[model samples]
Target: MTADTSVRFREFKMPDVGEGLTEAEILSWYVKPGDTVTDGQVVCEVETAKAAVELPIPYDGVVHELRFGEGTTVDVGTSIITIDVAPGSGPAEEPAAAEPPAASVPTPTAPAEEAEEEKPKGRQPVLVGYGVAESSTKRRPRKQAAPAPEQSAAAAIQAEMNGHGAAPAAPEDRPRPLAKPPVRKLAKDLGIDLATVTPTGPDGIITREDVHAAAAPAPAPAAEAVPAPAPAPEAVPVTAGARETRVPIKGVRKATAAAMVGSAFTAPHVTEFVTVDVTRTMKLVEELKADKDMAGLRVNPLLLIAKALLVAIRRNPEVNAAWDEAAQEIVLKHYVNLGIAAATPRGLIVPNIKDAHDKTLPELASALGDLVATAREGKTTPAAMQGGTVTITNVGVFGVDTGTPILNPGESAILAVGAIKLQPWVHKGKIKPRQVTTLALSFDHRLVDGELGSKVLADIAAVLEQPKRLITWA
Candidate 1:
């Protein structure tokens, strides 16, 4: 019986899907209790701070329990699901099939001291080579003793009369507003006090929507004493809800915010702008589209812009480096990981092409096409985003002039490509309509001085102005 019990149940913990990700929100569950799953069958899909990933179960069995519901951000090494390895092998398991034992369930509501004492000190198993990680164990905030019974009853009655029967607990008596990890993080990002939010979720739980609503500014009160006349026909009705919509900052967006903040404050930025006539480059794009080598590839002005930036980096290699604060050294990289900033429904993500300096024009186009497609599909991996040395952002696609782009964390420089439009310019002799665009290059001043930065920007503009430079530069 002991041996049978040992092999009867198996627990699957959330794996670190990305590099050192401490937690992940379970976006969806593919399996539920009593569902049969085979080894390697995907059981759930989770969104980490980096990207959305599907998790596959390792053991084949009947799904016995789901520890956390969908949308819960579970810590790494915590068991998310249990499987009955041997579903019907014993009579002892028959009575327990309907309900899992209390011992198997985690007591998150337990007192902090009791929880600390009860939790196992031994390290939990993780994927091989990942080693054991300290669980992001959150201790529930202690609740203060309730007020006198009479006061509590009166408060409850008063609350009931107000429609939302749930009485607001005393400041000290309020347990941590019942919220998931992601919701808590969102509240922190938005500078909202969760205790002040009125929870509408079932069972008095604070949700992301609650936090977002709290972050939204309240409507201004009317000052007039008398009734005001209705507005004219052209006037649009305005309300706080209709005027603005709030989106919870989490996952990739949250990460991007933190990264941009760090990069902006830490690095001294120097921006240089130049206007160039890209009529030649635009014609080259059409030529490339017709070429057999570039067929089936995404041939666009951005492709040439990316190539131009890479060529500029090759010419001014010193600009393609990072400032290491710890060692107080400028780490110059020989290979360029060209990051293309792509905006998605989730948020902005920069999944880079590795060793971009080594790829030919056609090869570069293919890589860019694949990267953009994968990012749009939300399949970009964390590995693809790491080790980026330089980046390019095309604001031209949005039909806007160039703006100074913020550098990606740990990268040296970022180039912004503005919209190419027909403008009158002094060509070889006369002023005629020409395809012109503005380019803005922003780099870390600590590593790249004005001359080097100017040179790099000039080279990119020069390449775009003359498409034949690609062959000469190579």
Candidate 2:
């Protein structure tokens, strides 16, 4: 390939999808070698620790090579694909174009020097997959080495093992076992060896299940001294078939687990619970459902419960704060990023409504509806899940009483709403069947004292008890 050639190739590196995320697992590839792709076209989908994000190709090009296959967890800065940005660059000519000229052919200087000469002058605009800091260093073209007979045989075996078109490793070293970063991390955590575990995934890849199976304890030996040559009884499997399934904690679930553990141990937690008659709140839910402003939006008991929590935060703004352990200070937030805990097939994810304190009742309801819909579809972006000041988890949907929920990391408080049931209660000096529910507020004791926590819970309960308080409180 001559440096003066007009055709140019660009390498697209994996980007950090989430804030400072180290790696992401490629879920699927939308394009392959030889396929034509346009700028801003989604080339692949990747699942980070927080959420699944689709990556768009930043420039128009014909795909030349996909460096990594689907299911591979690539680091943020590693190049994953090559694109021929120059028009009229045919797929068949890609290999020849990438190859250096013969030694006998005349050239001005070395390939690296030629690339340096061809490098664009001055500062270049940062491309989508490229990092902020641009490097002018040019890479020399790699020379193809002839393989020995033994190496050729080993390469064939390695290729078969990888199943997909991953390049084989060096002949002296065994090919690294194929597993996603999360699965590899799980193996490392359990001290299980990937080489020993049998792979069941496509292309002989180790899966999370394979790692767990390797971690399971072996059956104990019989204690009895058996007489010579007696036929051993057929060993019974310890685990019942399809009775129980073990899912490896990863992605959203793994992130939630880590955050919960950090919050539980780092911050001293204090929980306060209260049972309130929310008959008025339920009646208002029905009223709002019929109202013109709330039309075509999700108006439910949880919506009112969320609004009540917001009102309580407004009344007790001190509780809407976070503990800054690093800085040794308490950070009070004026605006509320209200998180609503959602349980999906992936796991528990809390996608918050940004600036919930600034939104009206109808606007809040619309945001809540959109948040729930996005979460249910597993399309919630990582940005929507960050910077939360407080969270409300409605356990009522599962027909359960309130739980002393753990505080979301960086947030001071979380409110749990229990199931609303009809119970006989004293109302206006007489026993009456009214809608009642329990509320539990858990907060970081370092930032919120028991008095403040109790006040916040009481405020929420009061708002629910008298729906008119929402109007007056605002």
Candidate 3:
């Protein structure tokens, strides 16, 4: 007896990489069909709304199929790749193309009387001899033949696959429009039926632009003879292909834009600004950079600024709270997940440190270092960005003054630190050159009133101004 050597195909689906994320875009594929892959090997990178994540193939196999192409956005749980686990054992195509033998196929040549006897009775074919006994509740009678549309579609496809020309199907019985799932979704969203969209893609498939063209309104009747309007800047066409470039917003940028927009509108934001003399804090940063305790850690004004903000939150605990609209409650958090906004090539991502309020100065500095490093490398996880109680965005690094930073969605407040510069200030008695910077604190008005917001801003300013408040205030 011959030992069975059959190919087994295993499909890898798009995973929900981020909490509640529904889809991800395939950024690039590291391997193509016929490439051998080992278990836990990174096969491709996908960019979800949160971040770019590398997906590892879970089993050793030869890649048999890549279901979607790169740049295609696929829904979670949909199979993106198929692997032939038993690659060399048998021919991969045999199993997929195998069909029942001719002898088993119901013969059309059977006599009418015999065919009638072979026809299923009231049972209507369930698991062999497992169907219900006849009763008043009648099942719909099965059709003797396949639906006309389905039969036409199958015939046309079969003809094409067999390398034979098929008689053109009637318009009414035309095969369902040829488009990928995403294109179909786009057509549906635009309220344009795929059947009505003209096909401009290879092999008579409907492209995205075809759908858009169908959705475009017909030109106004030429009889209305209106005077030609002056061409607008955007309306003028350029020949050099350098006038404007369009970038498709997806992945992190798209998510950040939506979240920022929602935060701006949903949260009643109240921003407070304060200019502070951070000459002492700047000196402390240099001292800390040299200190053995802070050795090898990123010791900068931003670090001290973060510490100042944490201290401010500690002194004004009421500012560390969230508004639960559904619960209609003000939830005060005991622990703070301090967020530091980092600008990456992808977009601005705010990955927070867990329990930052409990960490020592050195520990906080280390955490900040890791957070910024990971964010810069585009390796920050979604969990690190979630559950943030407050955020600090340092615009100073960009040589800008303070900005009214938007709250990071669910977080209560965001502190914006401005560029530190040497300016003449009225120190003690006379004007003296001092390192001064401006700070802007934006908070959800419903959670933090003007007084509470002011106190938080003031505490942060005092901590930066004195640098000793970190010890005494703590």
Candidate 4:
């Protein structure tokens, strides 16, 4: 086909969706070759280490080619797709044929030559936050060059010594096993070679189950010495069956696992539990639900509990801090980004409410509502999950009594709230039923001593027991 010289092609590269994320896996593509696309229209969805994010095309164009297929893990700054910005431009001249390269170059000089050859013909400024530079590189006419006899001889000798005389295989020409990044990682972790595993997934894709089956130890041969004994039938191979299935951990689950492990190991955690009577807090929750100001807002025990925690933090600002291991110091935060640990279908994600200390009760309720809704939809942004100072995990929602939760990475403490149950207790010197719940506070012992943690926990318990303490303490 003739080249359309007048048509300007734009390449869109994979971007770092989260801060410092180096790579992402393309989950799916919304546009294909020759499809008309508009500026700011979502072209693909990618799953980064943090979350699934939709990428929008920056300029209007017709899709020319998709460089990578879905489920491919592409590094940041790698070209992912090409678009013809001037698709209506008339076709121009036929491109010149590429000439054969000179043979027998020294290994050290090859990289430099490749770099020079790949240099762009022109450069243009990229859109902000896209994370890739625009290059206007045009194909240059190549000139054929013949190798020297001595150089060819040297290359052959070198290749012979390496046990491979054939030219390196092109990536597209080679048979690459079809598997998602997570499955590939699972195979690597299990020490199973993907090439040896039989794929069972759609389109000959290798799955986590296939990797695990490959990694399973083979049955040992029957002993020759037991010839007289009846022959033992071949051992049945264990397969992932109806009773059990293996799910590959990836995206948010993988990140959460790493963060939890790091936090559990790095922080010297000290957990303190207190059983508090939260009758007042429950009553306040009901009152807030009926109040005109809280109409259409999420009004629950968690809301008041969050407010109580903020008030407690205000009273004990020392609790609102993080241990800076790199700096070898305790970093105190002036403002609270209150993280509410949300359990989604993907995994446990903690998307904090920004500047929660500054927000009024109504505003905090609204933010909480939005955060919960976004998290349930699995659309919590990576930015929303960062910079949390303290976190609250309400195991109570699941009918659990209490738990000593591990702290989120870079944060000092996490509070676990248990189910509020009505139990018999002495009220005004008489036996009566009261709303009681257990609260567990886990903190970094390095930054928060027992006295400080106890005070913070006590402040929260006091506010729950006496709802008016929020106004008074504030």
Clash number for each model:
0, 0, 0, 0
Question: lDDT values of the candidates?
Answer: 0.73, 0.71, 0.72, 0.73
> What C-alpha lDDT, on a 0 to 100 scale, does residue 284 get in candidate 1?
91
Error of 4 at 128 (Å): 7.2
lDDT of 4 by residue, 16-96 (tens): 778788888777788887788875577888878887777767546677667777767778877677665655444323222
In Å, residue 29's CA in model 4 sits off its true spot by: 1.8
lDDT of 1 by residue, 104-152 (tens): 3232221111111011122233332122222211223444765556655
lDDT of 3 by residue, 1-474 (tens): 001112145556677778679999887788887789875566877888997776767556677767777778888767677666655443423223132221111211111110011111222111111111121111235469755674454464344334333444345544465564446667767777787778986547676668768877743111212223212113335469596866678889999999999999999999999999999998988888889988888889888888888888888899999989999999999999999999987789999988899888888887898788788777676767888999998999989988989999988999999999999999999999999999999999999999999999999999999999899988
Worst 10 residues of 2 by lDDT: 101-110
Please give the distance, in angstroms, between residue 41's alpha carbon in candidate 2 and its true position after superposition.
0.3
Extract clashing residue pairs from model 4: none
Where in model 4 is the C-alpha error above 4 Å? 1-7, 91-244
Q: Which ten residues in a row have the lowest lDDT in candidate 3?
A: 111-120
Residue 8 in candidate 2 has what lDDT? Answer: 51
Q: Cα miss at 114, model 3 (Å)?
A: 35
TM-score: the better of candidates 3 and 4? 4
Candidate number that wins on TM-score, 2 or 3: 2
Cα deviation in Å at residue 109, candidate 2? 26
Candidate 1 ranges beyond 4 A from true positions: 1-6, 91-245
